[model samples]
Target: MAKDNRIQMLPAEWRASTTLSGVYALRMLGMFLVLPVLALYAAGLPGAADNKALVGLAMGMYGLTQALMQLPLGMASDRFGRKKVIYFGLIVFAAGSFMAAAADTLEMLVAARAVQGAGAVSAAVTALLADLTRDGVRTRAMSMVGLSIGLTFSVSLVLAPILTELVGVPGLFALTGVLTVISIGVVAWATPNPQISKLHEDAEAQPARMGEVLRDSRLLGYDFGIFALHASQMALFTALPFALVDLGWDKVQHWKVYLPATVIGLIAMVPLVIVGETRNKLKQVFLLGIACVAAAQIVLFAGLGSLWSIGLCLAVYFIGFNVLEASLPSMVSKTAPSDLKGTAMGVYNTMQSVGLFSGGAVGGLLFQHYGFSGVFGFCTALLLLWLLVAACAPAPQPVKNLGFAVPPAWQGRQEPLRQRLSAVAGIEAVRFSSDGQTVYIKALQEGFDQTAAEQIISGAN
Candidate 1:
């Protein structure tokens, strides 16, 4: 049979990806939904008035635990199986939700939130995503997951008021618990098992060299970008709720503002993103995003008390936030060595966890003492620092994606095959092993011919 080289969408895999992505997004949405209203809710809880610090701890400790446990859990998934790990995580998350729901005081809620953080399984979900997709379309598949999360953030903000209005804070936690349970059903019944791609890292692959990954400045740049992006997000949310309240909006109606800001931000972001990707100006785009974030912080610091002014600042902030959110992974993928993609992502996620924790923790303390201006000031300083780091960082070479198939007879002659594959036009990196060989050709994505290379490899064999 002739090999097809066309870049076609995966119709068959869409349903599973969509379902699983929704499940992942829903989990994240549960956490984010409370962001815009948590401050008000916390102020009302018994003992919350005495120690708002505990509330901050409760809010941010989840990220700390999440960062600590993510790698181990992901490794465990490799050993114990993805579904099993994910199921366990979901159960733990549900338990945390229930604990928070049943809490009589702020202290209990904090403990429950920390327990919820203990269930961090982002790496496992990502590993499963890679497991379920073919090499050629894996990035696009992953993008669907990214898109789901983005959509969830936007939708959760819009829905938070409505959900909170109907069920209140405790009910929101309960609803999240229920949603997680439903996702387990979706996982068991709907997701397909792709014949695992031996070409990519498997459950049992030896952990890649951390030293090498850490030393790669380019990868570190991408990691820093992720950290900064998430940190900014968490920090902004810490004060945004209170800021809205001071602007005369009630907690229940805050989503009215969120809905429009998010929508406008989403709309504004697409064009800038397209221009960056299409025009090969990703570095320029990234720096610009940092600048925008810094500017937004200034705007927020100056004008948060007025509803219209706050809206305007948010419009600016989300424009930067959304673009950077979409681009960071792509930057990571392009910068990371193909074999170490999993390891790089693991480290990147760890950085994100650190950011999430620090952002909320620091933002909370800043808010407690210095008011909203201090919170935005902190974000501004962080962004400026990040901008400097990114500005000095080296830009990545655009990698091309092309591959060759190994014929049956020469499966054992992998090293020589890698040598030959490397000689192919536009091929830049090659990884070949006895089990299933993969050739990562670096050329323009659209310019490479997958079929012709397959024929060449078959003929050579």
Candidate 2:
């Protein structure tokens, strides 16, 4: 069969990717559905009065545990298998949801949320996708996962009020539990198993690379970028629904505000993202996004007196939020070494989880003591720091991720094969799995000679 150079996914790959991606979407949807209304619900719960700190903790408790356990879960998947770990996590997530549903006190709420966080399995999911995919199509597969999370966030925001109105917060929690439980069925029945497990350089995190991943300034830039972005988001949301209600928007009708803002924000994101990827202006786009997020927070703080003002600010905020959210992972993948890709992402996710925790924790603390200005100001400072991080970061190489099948004949002798493939001009990196079923490479320049590279891989050159 003649080799086709254009990027495409196998049918099985697409089925697995989309199904796993659905799992991500479902998880994110469960997490975010409460964001738009949690504050209001907490204030009404028993023992919530004057317990602002615990309430804050309740809001971000999931992040605290998620951050702490993310790597361990990834490593566990490496040992016990990805599906098993994911199933365990999902079960834990469902249990937490039910606990949250049963809680009537703020302290109980926080504990349930913490339990919810303990089910952190994001790295495992990514690792599984890596296990299932060839490097060439990994980015596309990852994007599907990323898009699911992003889209779910927007939909969750819009649905929060509706869900809250129909079922109340506890009922919503119950619904999430049901959703997560359903996903386990989807996983067992619909997801395909990988033929063999291998250490994918581009996907799974390695313990040994911890130092190198941490030390890289470029990776750190992406790290701080995600951290600040999510932190500001969590902080803004801690107060945003309350801010909306203060301006005469009904608590149950908040989705009216979120729908337009989320949609418009997403629409506004397209052009800049295109320019960043197509024009190779990623750094510029990244910095601009941080600035936009800060500016939106500032606007929200200043213009809280009007519903329209808050709506406008949300649109601005989501535009920046969506762009930063979409681009940061891409930057991480591009900046990380192939072997440390998983490790780099693990650290990145930890920062993100920390940001999630801090946003709620710190935002609530400040709001209790200093009012709304303090929370937004704190978030703004974080965004500014991310801006500086982006400014000083190393320029990322403009290369695309590619994967090729290593013919079975060469199987176990991939070491010598990598040695030969690495010698080819324009091939910046070459790596193979332990089983030698896949060959992953990064091209050095634009319009890389894929045909020439394949000839070398086929041992036909």
| The best candidate in terms of TM-score | 2
TM-score of each: 0.92, 0.94
- 159-216, model 2: which lDDT tens digit per residue? 9999899999999899999999999998889988888766776677777769999898
Clashing pairs in 2: 136-402, 136-403, 205-342, 205-343
Model 1 spans > 4 angstroms off: 1-12, 193-199, 202-208, 400-407, 433-436, 445-452, 458-461
Per-residue lDDT of 1-461 in model 1, one digit per residue for the tens?
Answer: 12224555476567657877887897897788777766578667887784545556666778888988888888887778888888899888888888888887877888888888888867777777767765566666677888988888888888988889999999888888888888888877887664663325421222556676799988888788788777777878777877777767788888888878899889988988887777787888878878878898988877665788777777777788888887787777677666666677778878988888888778778878887788888888888888999999876655643334456755777777667666656556766433565544444444444555565667633
RMSD of 2: 2.2
RMSD to the true structure for each prediction, in A, is: 2.7, 2.2
